[model samples]
Target: MPDLLTDRLLLRPWRESDLEPWAAMNADPEVRAQLGELLTREQSDAVVAGMRADFDARGFGWWALQVRATGEFVGRAGLDVVGADLPYTGVDVGWRLRRSAWGNGYATEAALACLAFAFDELALEEVVASTTVRNVRSQAVMRRIGMTRDPADDFEDPSVPEGPLRACVLYRKQAR
Candidate 1:
């Protein structure tokens, strides 16, 4: 698939060349602290490969986010269906970026694009986003994009190991 461009960024499938930078960002302790576990280089490679395959198979997954002007690979943001076994199985929005990309509204921009795709192109019924209890930044983006908190929807991530951030705040927005 080709890249999905926003005004300032290019969201595309992962390429072999993206492995190093992706691994570095995923290895960052601060970034990994929020995103669950730090990925080893090999693990990162597998992740990139899996994302590529998933995109090919499903027509949508997290797209590698790149700065359009500089061509710098920032990170990724896109729509994913939470595991089928989970309560929420519809499109779910997500993002992760390098430390340098933080505080610049890229996450929100990329996420908005994904939501547009989900609601407009995919004709999805709804999109949900969740963040660790402590990840206020992510929670803020969810709110800024019009997702409303559904406290009843919040649940311990059956995926994350038991820990301080195991519980998550769930937010949802229905397609108009």
Candidate 2:
């Protein structure tokens, strides 16, 4: 897959050096606050492996986010197929930035790039983003990217145990 460039960020393929920071980010309590439990080093590396495989197979997957000026690894952003058996199914735009990377609008920037690639390059009809009902930060990014939400589209995430995180709200943006 080609690297996506924004005004200040470079969304490119994963690298071996990224594993260390990636694992550290996954272990941060605040960073994983809405993402469930922390991941071990092995689990984190496995996640990177899965993302790489997805990119090789589909030519589109989460890209390792980096700051262009300083070449700092920030996080990841891309499109992923919403799993089967979920209340809904389709491609979804997602972004996860390190705790230090927050408050800079990086998530919104990366998500907008993913949305453009989905609608313009991939020609996907629609893309959805779902998050825990309490995750207003991500929901804000969804809105900033022009996704609209319908209360009727909300559902309880079957994978998550019954709790606040189980209730998820979905937002969608159709190709224009």
Candidate 3:
């Protein structure tokens, strides 16, 4: 897919240079708080590689997000096909920003761009997002992008080991 530009953010494909900071972000305890355990360097690079492959195969996946003016890699934001074992199946919007990038409105900005691409470019009818019930920050981003949630849609993520992160809440936005 082509690069998506917001007023302050650029959503583009992963880069080779992103490995170091990406690994650093993944290793941060605060950044990993809602996602999962900290990942090893190999594990982090593998994620970027997988994102590149997924975009090549399907034309859309997580984009390596950057600040347009400073050209700093802030984090990642994009869509992924929800795993089939989940209670529901659909494209899910996601973002992972560096700790320094938090509370800067970057996630909301990038997410709105991705949501527009999902609806306006790809013609998808809906997109979803889910996180652990404790991940209120991500849920706030979801709401900021106009996604809504139904209490009944919340379910346990079987893949996540029993922990605070296992109980997930689902949110969705429909094409307008």
Candidate 4:
């Protein structure tokens, strides 16, 4: 997939150099609060590898987010196919930003771009997003992107172990 350029962010494929910062971001407790347990170095490396493979094979996946002017890797935002066991089965938009990048509106900006890519470039009928019921920050991003939430669509994420992160809320937007 072609790299997406927003006024302040660049969404592109993962790079070898991103591993260190990516691992650091994954290990941050504050950042991992909503996502899951902190990831070890090997686990973080594996995720980067998987993202690269997915992007190569599918032409779209979690693209790395960077500040265009400073060329700093802020985080990642893009779409993924939800696992079949989940209540929702479709492409889902998601994002992860470094703790330092939080409250900067970067997630909302990049997410809106990915939503357009899903509907316009891929021609997907709809895209969904989910966050732990307690992840208000992510829920805010979903709302900022114009996704609607229905409590009835929410579910306990089957993949997440029974914990604070298991119960999730689903939000979705259909192609306009």
Candidate 5:
């Protein structure tokens, strides 16, 4: 995928040097809380490898989110086809930023760009995003990006731990 530029972010592929900070973010409890599990450095490397391979093979996946002005790695935002049993399948929009990058509209900005990529570049008909019932912040971002809830499409995420089926809220926006 081509490197995407926003006002403050540079969306590009992952680099070998990004592992340390990425692992740190993955190890952070608060960050991991939303993601369901904390990853060790080895696990983080495996993830980076998977992401790199996905991009090479599919031409698109999660791109590393970096600060354009400072050249700092903040987090990642991009398109993904989450392989979980649910009502819908195919490309989905998602993002995850460092705690310091939160509340700065970076998520919304980067995500809107990704949506544009999906609808325009990828020629997708629609994109979907879902979060745990308790993840209000993500849900709010979904609404901010003009995605609407589809209650009938909601279901338990099989990839998540087997406990209480956390109500997964599915939100989607159609391509124009």
Candidate 6:
């Protein structure tokens, strides 16, 4: 997939250099809270490896996000198949940024761009995003990107342990 650019961010393919910071970001407790667990460096490395392979085979997956002017890796935001069984199934949009990058509207900006890519470039009819009910921050990002939540579509994420993270909220946006 071609790189996507907004006024302040660039969504592009991952680079070898991103591994260290990516691992650090994944290891952050605040970030991991939404994800339900912190990832080890090796686990984070494996994720990057899998994403790189996905991009190689599919032409699109999660893209590394950066500050275009500074070239600093903020985090990743892009499209991917919703791998787990859920009430909805198809391509989904997601984002994660360093703690320093939070409250900057970067997630909303990058997600909107990915939605455009999904609806226009890929001609997909819809895109979905889900987060634990506790993750109000991510739900806010979903709302900012014009996704709407339907209570009827919400479900417990089977992959999560039965605890604070198990109950999930789902949101979706249809191409206009």
Report, for every candidate in turn, its global Cα lDDT versus the true structure.
0.88, 0.95, 0.94, 0.93, 0.88, 0.92
Q: State the weakest 10-residue window (summed lDDT) of model 5.
A: 158-167
Better of 3 and 4 by TM-score: 3
lDDT by residue for model 4 over 1-176, one digit each (tens)?
68999999999988888999999999999999888889999999999899888888988999999999899999999999898899779999999999999998999999999999999999999999999999998999899999999999999988899898999999999999
Candidate 6 regions exceeding 4 Å error are none
Question: Each model's TM-score?
Answer: 0.96, 0.98, 0.98, 0.98, 0.95, 0.97
What tens-digit string does per-residue lDDT give for candidate 3 at 37-64?
Answer: 9999999999998999999998899999
Model 4 regions lying over 4 Å from their true place: none
Cα RMSD for predicted model 6: 0.9
lDDT at 49, model 2: 99
Clashing pairs in 5: none
Residues 75-148, candidate 5, lDDT per residue (tens digit)?
99999986857667878899998898989999998999899888878899989998887788999999999999
Per-residue CA lDDT of model 2 for 87-121, tens digit only, reads 89899899999999999999999999999899989
Specify the highest-lDDT model's number. Answer: 2
- Which one wins by lDDT: 2 or 3? 2
Q: What is the C-alpha RMSD of each candidate to the true structure, in Å?
A: 1.1, 0.6, 0.6, 0.8, 1.3, 0.9
Count of residue pairs whose backbone atoms collide, per candidate: 0, 0, 0, 0, 0, 0
Could you tell me the TM-score of candidate 4?
Answer: 0.98
lDDT of 1 by residue, 39-120 (tens): 9999999988888888888899989999999999989899877886666667789999999999999999999999888888
Clash count (model 4, backbone only): 0
Query: In candidate 3, which residue pairs clash?
Result: none
Residue 66 CA displacement from its true place in model 1, Å = 0.5
Model 3 collision count: 0
Give the distance in Å from residue 107's predicted Cα in candidate 6 to where it truly belongs.
Answer: 0.1
